[model samples]
Target: MNNAGRDTRQSTRFMLLYALAAAGGATAYVPFLTVLLPVRVADLAGAQDIAWLAYVAFFGAIASSLSNIGFGWLSDITGNRRGWIACGMVLSCALLLCVTQVQDLTGLIAVIVVWQLCLNMMLAPLTAWAGDCVPDRQKGLLGGLLSFSPALGALAGVVVTHPGMASDDVRLMLVAAMVVGCVSPVLIMGAPRRFPELNQPSAIDQTPRKARDWAALTPAIRMWIARLLMQISEAALFAYLYFWFRSISPGFGDNDVARVFGLVLLVSVPFSLLCGRWVDRHNRPNLPLVVGAALSAVGLLTMAAAQDLVLAIAGYVLFGIASAIFLALHSAQTLRVLPRPEHRGRDLGIFNLTNTVPSLIMPGLTLAMVPLFGFSGLFVLLTALAVVAGLLLVALPRPK
Candidate 1:
């Protein structure tokens, strides 16, 4: 092929790669909101003891974090990200399908925990794949593509099919998983090979090469910490957003709440892509992150104090825009800081801990705070988390 032809083909391939990664990521995240899904299921079934739902959610969180670390390390050793990614995607489908057979809460929680564990194996590696091969200049666009997660999750939230309707969640879950899972491997199959020799590097090395590698890796590490904190705030607020809203505005129903999340997500998509593209163009990842955090804090504080549903919904929109920007920029920014060309999977795995850790911590924190200060107290705590996350980014050494 001519040079121009070659360039066109390469651009096409990268676009495919971005789509596959985004699709697979959406599948992984779609099931994560199952906590909310089950709540609807329970309400439809006329079951009570709502607290069990939280337990199931916590179990899933722990499993997800553990799997992220394990599968990530495994991908590092194998130098084959697709193998594990495909496995996790398939396994999550099976577990999600099995969940349909459960009639009791124990069965429900058990299947969910297993499904979540398998699910993370797909997620941690899939996300790492982008960092493994994509150039730094494209990180922003990668973030923009990632906005598909919430969009997909929101769509999944509205189910014409439930368990009573022949297990709609499973049907959608399997279809989405298969499509995304199959595409993931095909897109990355031609990714430029790196670290042909898969030997483990010593974490103990003190050589200049090792030091340089460590320094290069700090941006990802610091961003991971920031993600963890931001997620803590986000998770805490989401975990109890309804309760908080109910206490302040008891009349709000499912339709109203759905509208709130929907509008917020709608406003967020463009903002997410815009921040990412701007950051890529300017090479200014940290600035967006700092601004996003501050904006999110203001929104959270507004939600905490608002008495009118309109104000709360407005707050949610602001929070969603900021959160979207934060999520996109942080992911792309981490790619810029990865140290080793060969071990992107390993480092990105560690980096994903920020995403998973808060899912585990936020629930407990939310529950503990409820009795002490109630819903209002949760927002104050969320603001603190956001502020700290912003401060951490500010403290990071300038990216080279």
Candidate 2:
């Protein structure tokens, strides 16, 4: 390639990076719009019963788990991600707006269910788009860029919900949604659709099942499963971190939660980006995945051991850093092993179940664990899970 052509290519890749980051940024608002709102939903729904939230969470998990494959399959056949992205955003935002008007459990449940479905529809295709263009070598960088978006979105959520700005919070969320809606078109217009070769099972394949088939578990698929397990450990903490903080240290408030989560994200962003750079430079993505998961396990254990809020915050920040590193590299590695590149949207959707399935199960598991294992026991269990996941990653054959 000519120097100018090479420079343009480099520029295009960087733009793609920022676009991915912005898409990640958009993902941040979901917690506020969905999971975080249930507190309000309890009051609005007149049930004041968290069980309803759990029910919604359970169903949402199912929808999220299924939508990945459903939309991914569609994206694979269509070869156009932008349309799905736009439709998902618009439908989800409308649902968010609709949910704000709900005033009962039935209404809340119905709206949330639909909203979750649409959000997943958007996310499945959007996430698959990441693997579509980027090669395995740059997956870590892409993962880092994708990882930071939630932090940015979290900040946006905080800004929109300033104390006494209740009237405007919904509006701000809508604005966030609108900003995300714009991302797909801009990405479509700018990024070149260079269709890379797909990794397909042979036409005359004698194997009983395709590796991507739900039943088949290749080394790479096993690695992805490990990544999913790690995410579940993280989700277990996420589902209950606020409740635990409140139970253990009620003096801390929402701002405290946001601040702690924000600090964690802040620490994580640099570490994640650096980990990605290290992976690209040295080709050692798995090492970081292993180390980061271990660190996170330690952090979780520390959180359980903490006697004061400061210690807990420290633990949270450490966990955040470790989780971020693992997520960035683990995702890149998973992208490398997908059974079908043409079906990235489909395969990634299925893989994302690892991420979403936990969200569904973790909350109930946390509640159940606390009664039996208590918080410390929960942490210990989480630590063990993380270790197992890390070891599984180590066991996977190094990708060529």
Candidate 3:
């Protein structure tokens, strides 16, 4: 094969590998955060695990948010994302084992805080690394591929938390092993130097720009806020979907809910990929987001109005697929608006705040809204948020 063909093949392979590693990164947290942490907190804190979980969550979010930006910038200076990722993978995986040693909520909190810090060390650079290698045209497909991460994360949670795992230590060990297994392939077999700058030599940029103030970079900021809004809705549903379902029907089991949740995730992967390819084919790049946001609004509306289990599930499926499309494609498209190649890590870190920030927002929002108007009211508010998020992109000035 010619050089050009080789580069194409390598690029394809790199995207696939990156997607796998990204999914692995999600596994680093989703399973533990969703399943094990809660169980551990309950075991330690007993009746107060809810409060303890909130404390761990609040502190953990702060730790992750700070570390993501900090390490992303560090990677920018070092030009060694892979090295940082490898180091992070090792350290964070070690921290997973530490979770097994914690005998109290306070100790668990400490381990979680530190683990979050180590986890984002891998996550931050791993996120920015894509823009450093892949060009804008292919970012859509990359985003489509990235949709796989959450699915795998959820699957990992299911696997390790299965009834067969009788002990917390065993579960934690399996999680660490899974994290290592999922993430190591990329570190071992590095992205081909087809895009040499993806492997830029160690160098420092002492100047970190005030990226927020730049007029030219305004679109990226808009995209960031838009994403944060949509994510808030996602976070809310994620935390409360079970209770919301129960409110509809007392007989709805966790397995039924899980199947519905899992099916939506499975369906969204292909839907997002199709939408990503559509955007790539046409120059109407923001069209999918606008359309996705509209559909998300409709989905949320459907759920709010749903009177039966069947209707509620249908509405949730719609919302799930639409929101997934918006988020997945929006992520890849954010790369287009980032003005600084050298600062890709830093800027992407800023963009990623949307992910962590929602956790901080959701608890307060849920408390204030759910009690007043119930889940239906909350869904209506989310519908409005999604609409506004879509509009932010719609009103954005087009690139000349």
Candidate 4:
């Protein structure tokens, strides 16, 4: 094979490793946040104080948002990605293990805040590192690979929380170990430094241009908005998913929910991979993204209309698959739309707001909506949000 082919192969391998590492990092905390933390909080604060789960989520979201932006900017300024990831992973692992020791609400909150910061330190830079290295054409494949992260996260939750697990501390330790093990490949191999076309000037160079230059950014901005709206729906559901399941079927347990979630994610993986490949081959990401959003809306509406456990699970599956496709495709497309290569890290950080901000708002949104209208109302709102997200994508100008 030619040099270009070899580089492409190598880059593909690197991105695969990076994607897995990202998944590992996510596994460490996502389950903890979505599944374990709520249970732990309820256990410590009393089942009646379940509202504290929202507070903890809010705190963690704020910390993660700020830290993600800060660390992304710092990586750009220092011109280093690997070091930040390594350092952050180490600190995150140590802190995660410490979480099992927290005995009170205040202590738990403190640990979550710090843990969020540490996790973002790794995540932000890791995302930036992708823009720094991956060629635009391959972003779709990368995004497809990224879909595995959430699946792995859900599976990790199942593993750690399984009834046969040793102890909470030991479970925590296992999560920490997974984080280290997953990230070790990227760190050990070192960040890829030679993508010949990796940061070449596109139409939207840092230099000033006319209205058209600004217009060029609209696609990325639209995708950002789309992801934000869809994520709001996702965050609302994820935060309350456990409770929702319990309310729907009091007989079901955490393991049952995890199994359903994991199955949905696993089903999404191959579909996401195929969607990514289609996006890459066709150079038409918008169609898939918009379709995914629409699918999510359908899923939300399904959930809103469901009156039984089987129906609820079906709705979740639809929503989960749609979310997986949209997120993976949108992520792959992000690298293509960034306006400034010189500040790719910072720009990507800004884009990440779409991810973190939803978490911040979802808690408040859920509390306000659920009390007034119940889960049905919440799902209806989410359905509308998903539809709007798709519409925004439709508004974007077609790629040149």
Candidate 5:
């Protein structure tokens, strides 16, 4: 009983530290990628800014996808998650500083590709380390804790881009420093001995991961598809939200949309935390995802049905809240459905595809949908996708 009590405390502390690290990881890239990357491209590319931004995004996504898988497999083979993360952080920060020195677009792309490779070297393993440490019973709360990452990341962007301080090198320096600060504490501390040999760095998992072992992931596969669908919508809104709001009210400016966007994400924090606790307590994990998707579908529908500014904003608020929770909770639940502990890092890197693929798919999807049927048409299509995501989760077999 005494041992059990100690273990519980250790696990709780681990979750908190892990959550901080997750937020730090987001801080590393979110500000730079979202705000600074385009600014850099525009400064270098001159009049071809749009073309340059597209190329950078395309190459960056490809690099992010491939490197996440490669580095994750490396970590798995080496049987050390933390070591790789530390090395990756240092190298990526060095590369991040190098980002300030690039004078041409070609050089910028080259640097970004390498930086992305090193960045995922940290991210992929950091993600899998949580799976190694946290048990299924706590994944819901773990995910809830992780829900803070993106919000803080957005806030970090605001911080690095403050009007008073305005040097590209200085901004990059702040980002690199923030990454080190947020990720260092967890790296210094040791992993908890909460699970069976999970924390041990002994040997590679070289046994062939067979087809039969893969069969156990039917639910995970459903989750994969559902998450992809939800992300498609989220990515679309992420890309075109400003335009959509501007369409409703031509008076809407970038600052207006940015403020609204950040606020909506901030609001999701309490909802996700509360829902995460509820999910852990009830163990009906799929239900919340289903409900969140359905509500998001309604939100999209509301976007279509009410094109007026007030109703559109309300619709977006609902969609943003629901989508945020679904994404957060689904991330934790994905760990529960993974087949083998040994391959957790690699499989998670595969899951990381869902994050990057949308950028690829949504741009083409939005262009195809919006030109034909207008923003209303795109909203309706997104509504359909969100519904399908919900139904997929509904089909998942429940716990006995």
Candidate 6:
């Protein structure tokens, strides 16, 4: 292979391994948040399950939001990504084991808070590490590779929730073990050191730019807003999906919903990968992001209008595919917008607010909307948000 071909192969290998690490890290605790935590809350709280779940989610979100930024900043200062990632993986794994011992809502909440902290300590640095190493041209391909993260997250849920698992403690241990297994490769091999220039922002021009000079910053800001809007829609729908499905179709149980969700994620994997490849090959990354948002709007509208399970499932499939593409692609594109490579970790941490802030807002949004206009109202609101999300991207100036 020529040097270019060799470099491409190396990038592909790194991205795939990185994606696997991301998937494993995600699988470790995401299932717990989406599935097991609720069950545990119900088990511990009885009639107060709903309220306790809210509390846990509220605290967990706060922990996640703060830790993501804090740890990312810490990584920036230390100029080390792998060490933080490795330490975080180990810490989170140990904490996951500690969770198995928590017998009450308070104890569980405490453990989850600590788990969120450790998880982000790993995740934020990992995200910044990508920006440090991956060239801009390969970002779309990287995003496509990242499509596996969600699939792995959903699959983790399915595996841990299996009837054969039988014991909650055993399931928790398995989740931690899987985290270790998945993250081991990246930790052991480590990422290439970031270019020294990427860690020295002071050497670059620090003067405020005129309007003409603002071109580079505009897309990044728009992308941030775009992601925030889309995530709000996703968070609302995801948190309430089970209840919404139950209300629409009484026969559908937790397992049924899980299966549907997992299938949707699985189906989306190829489409997302294809979209990423297309974006990279065509050099039209922004267009697919816009399309993904528009598709999400259509899906939300379909669900809002539908009164039956079939229609709802169809809507979910569309929305799932769109969300998968949008998130994966957006992630890759984000690396393009950072103004200062030296502050990549901190900047990415700030960008992650789009991910975490929505969690804080969605619960309240759901509470307010569901009572006033029901799921239909919520979907309609989400549809509008998706539309706006797409439109915001239109304002992004084309790459020079």
State which candidate has the highest lDDT.
4
> What order do candidates take by lDDT, descending?
4, 5, 6, 3, 2, 1
Q: Write the residue-wise lDDT of candidate 5 on 1-400 in tens digits.
A: 9988667543666788888889889888877776677668768987676557656767887899899988888898998889999999999999999987999899999998899999999999999988888877777898788888877776777777766665889999998999898899899975665587554433435555565546577888899999999988887776567567877898875446656666777788889999999988888888999999999999999998876899999999999889989999999989888777788888889998988787777766766777698888888999999999999999888765
Lowest lDDT 10-residue stretch of candidate 4:
199-208
Candidate number of the best TM-score: 4
Model 6 lDDT tens row, 200-274: 564445656565347557778899999999999877666667678988998876667767777877787888889
* Model 1 misplacement above 4 A: 1-13, 31-36, 40-50, 159-218, 246-256
* TM-score: model 1 vs. ground truth: 0.83
TM-score of each: 0.83, 0.88, 0.88, 0.95, 0.88, 0.93
Candidate 3 global lDDT: 0.81
Which of the two, 2 or 4, has more lDDT? Answer: 4
Error of 3 at 122 (Å): 0.5
**Candidate 2, which ten residues in sequence have the lowest lDDT sum?**
195-204
- Per-candidate Cα RMSD to the true structure, in Å, reads 4.2, 3.3, 3.8, 2.0, 3.6, 2.3
lDDT of 2: 0.68
Any idea what lDDT model 4 has? Answer: 0.84
lDDT of 1 by residue, 243-277 (tens): 55666688865445544655566567777788778
171-202 per-residue lDDT for model 4 (tens digits) = 78888888888998988875574775666555
Taking the candidates one at a time, how many backbone clashes does each contain? 0, 3, 0, 0, 0, 0
Model 2 / residue 77 / CA error / Å: 1.1
The total of clashing pairs for model 2 equals 3
Clashing pairs in 3: none
